[model samples]
Target: MRRVWTSYAFRRILQSVFVIWLVSTITFLLMHFMPGDPIEIMAGRLNSAGMSHDQALATAANIVNYDPDASVWAQYLDFLKGLVTLDMGNSLTSPSKTVFDHVMEYLPWTLFAVGAGIVLATVIGLSIGMAAAYRRGSAFDHAMTSIGSFLTGVPNYILIAAVVVIGYTVLGILPFLDMRGRVTAGVEPGFDPVFFGDALYHAILPIIAFAFTATGSFLLNMKAATTEVLTEDYVTVARARGLKPGRISRSYVGRNAMLPVIPQVALQMGTLVGGSIVIEQILDYPGVGQMLMSAISDRDYPVVQAAVIILATSVVIASLIVDLVLVKIDPRIKTEGQDA
Candidate 1:
């Protein structure tokens, strides 16, 4: 068992490194060759504010570590060296801030919102899905399945826009919910209830948008898994033994049905940071997605590169962790791996 786990971990680590390196290289190349120049954009803004063309050009180049005169090969080599040393350097838009600083500043809030949304979606999905399976083909099941399908198809940003418009125009109320930001201004940042409550209040719309859209897919998956498990011979044996229906549903059917969903959850975890970009922008939420959008608009290459690396690395690591967890949870996986 130890040997198997050790081998698995070692293989996964190599795979993760390769995946991250590939993604990082692609992102770096794209950012470098993209039409807009961060230094030129910065120079333009500075020039507008009365700085001489020469001064603005020099300042911009210094801040972003880019020189139009320098060869692309030289720039690429410098970027590679910085990456190897874990030095992402300064942001072109905000020269005072390092790439790591920007990531640390915005990533946690995204994690909070996305993590809460995923958990909420999972609970709601699994509960409704299991019930629908028990009543498969009934009116209730059809109703739930239909709603889930519709919700799954709708994009989360659309949901956010719709809710904002409805809340303001139709309902004639807006401020009561504190619909933007991680917290209301003037609230002290702490572990206190007031601060926490305010943060959660501001997060409600973004969270709802993510959870509602995410729930539909999770619901459909859970329902399909439950349906298949319900027809299994073990389920039949459980029913024939005069087992209580609820026990059979919960223990025999529900437990087995959840196996497939575990992998889906891992994939969701991987994408949450990257996937929240649109919804976060619509809701004005402070998160990695919002940060990435702002950085892109400013042509902040280092920040953009860092954000892409973070998201891709998260996906690779999450997948590896899920693989190991699945192996632990299912003996069939172990047997298959051993045979291989």
Candidate 2:
């Protein structure tokens, strides 16, 4: 066990778990210490619906599965217990639904959009960046650099807004109303092509918005990395040995240049996931961000807490996976025990 502490993968897993626990705990504390009581707030709503104060209070407690009279520490323990059991209780506002149900319903769409966008951005960016690096001082290189700088400087929301305005308002080409949700009104989700196509159609705009800014960062980083790799002795030796340009670029340059940029993919994914809130709202898309916004508005504590924890956990896990991948791909990246 003591030896395990020095293992890099073990340390990363432990750190990820600790970070998630800390986030969930802080979210729990914030919810409890916030100005309003969730049970009281629910009770007030029930009272407005003609229930007597005492009846409303009792009903609210039962519905929320929370005892207002319990000590804060007791409640905190219960919260942690619920987490362990994967039971976040029922949603406060929509008492019929569990928080997990709500999160699961919407979380996948957000993940899809972010995942698809990052992948698209990384591929296109790396290719263009590599080409630009190879053609260092030419017009294409300068043009790409300027475009990348502009994209990096612009906020994703601004890009989203521009997309909406141009695609919907000016061009009159985009069917904004039809593209609002995850699928067409009557489409049942399944393995069918129609369902998949429609889902991608609705997701396209948000994906574009996410990919738009991320591409620039990837491009710039890949360009810089490729340029640096070009200066290395191995690359010069490969050229001196009369290797084909394509072989030298692919086997020697591209592979090495990608190392730095690969880690950025995880970081970019985290950023895009967080930014999904604004993008989803603007597009009126049904995803975790939209659900979180609605939960916060309705003071639905369980849903809010669950949504936050899920998002945080996704990011932490992405980062951990990237770190582990880096170790696997790059021999120079020494794990703690490897040093000995």
The 10-residue segment of model 2 with minimum total lDDT is: 331-340
Q: Can you tell me which runs of candidate 2 are displaced by over 4 Å?
A: 1-3, 336-340
lDDT of 2 at 336: 45
- Specify the highest-TM-score model's number: 2
lDDT of 1 by residue, 125-213 (tens): 98998889889999999999999998888777787788788987789786634668888889999999999998899888877877886
* Candidate 2 local lDDT, 1-340, one digit each (tens): 8777777789789889999999999999988888788788889999999999999999888878788889999999999998888788888888788778878999999999999999899899999999999999999999999999988999988988998899899999989988999999899999999999999999999999999889999999999999999999999999999999999999999989999998998899889999989999999999999999999999888889999999999999999999898888786775444676
Task: Give the C-alpha lDDT of model 2.
Answer: 0.91
TM-score computed on alpha carbons, candidate 1:
0.87
Error of 1 at 53 (Å): 6.5
Tell me the deviation in Å of residue 23 in model 2: 0.9
